[model samples]
Target: MQNQAEIQKLLVLCGTHSQTAFEQLYQQASPKLYGTAMRLLQNGELADEALQEAFVHIWHKASEYDPEKGSAFAWMATIVRYRALDIIRREKSQQNRSEAMANEQLALQQGEDFFIHELHVDEDQHLQLLQECLKALDSQQRKSVLLSYYYGYSHSEMVTRLKRPLGTIKSWIRRGMESVRECMQR
Candidate 1:
């Protein structure tokens, strides 16, 4: 539903390699695509890596986008998602990350849905809401939230990685969640 003109331009540029069109397209859609990759990948580094790869793919695969099937944004999203998933599957470093994510899934099956709020995010507006809520928390609290929810780090892992006490990590998560909830409600 967005970037119809840009997509048309991209379609034209696809065959011509127009840098201006590419830059325009990147400016219009990178945030949503990056946000989607971040939510899917969890790690900021991985998300950024995915974002880079996705843009490369966009450059190469722009000709394949068929707006008749869906929006141009949707087409770009699919390419980005595929590229991100492929990176996680193909690269050794990301494969380990995938394993860690798998372990987290197993942990979730034990009825310990402490990360339940993550499941509620399903919209672009929610991302904006998250950014707003995150701004309200302290730096450490914000990092803790992003690490846990965005990166899916376990509480203990976050504590160890952050060099903070377990209690502090727990407090950060709870307070961050409370703050985000209050902000979203308002």
Candidate 2:
């Protein structure tokens, strides 16, 4: 767990919509939350979904954080855990659906190979746009985004490999994603 005082500060900043503070909070807290989700759900895919949903909730509800209730990390962890549990429950209720059925549905979504093979020109345009957007990001943001999304490194892994503070890595990825979205919209 991170220092309570520091977590509190970040929470305060998050309430004010400070992206840097939110990034720092995520870096400081996400591993524990992810671990909690994994433990509860026991599936990497479900854990990822829970963590993503928890973060969206956190971003929207940062202002509701109350130190009087518990440490900031604990509060965040609770959210992730609950989200994981909910997903587990939902999955359990849908257990009658076979894995083969799920796979078939997924395959159906990808059944159209036109985009993959026939639309070479459109694919080229998208690839060019992506490259241009990536180029617009700062070096740290670019590297963080690429290493995480392209190479499948977790933020914790990136912290170790990049040898930078977790908060900075989180900030880089967050800002990098925003830049990519904005650029793509253009």
Each prediction's whole-model lDDT (CA): 0.75, 0.80
lDDT of 2 by residue, 98-128 (tens): 3433453364368632222333565587766
Candidate 1 runs further than 4 Å off: 91-186
Question: Model 1 over residues 32-82: C-alpha lDDT tens digits?
Answer: 989889877888888899999988888887777766678777788887898
Candidate closest to the true structure, highest TM-score? 2
Worst lDDT window (10 residues) for model 1?
Answer: 111-120
Q: For model 1, what is the error of residue 63's alpha carbon versus the real structure, in angstroms, after optimal superposition? A: 1.7
Q: How accurate is candidate 2 locally (lDDT)?
A: 0.80
- Using all chains and alpha carbons, the TM-scores for the candidates as numbered come to 0.46, 0.51
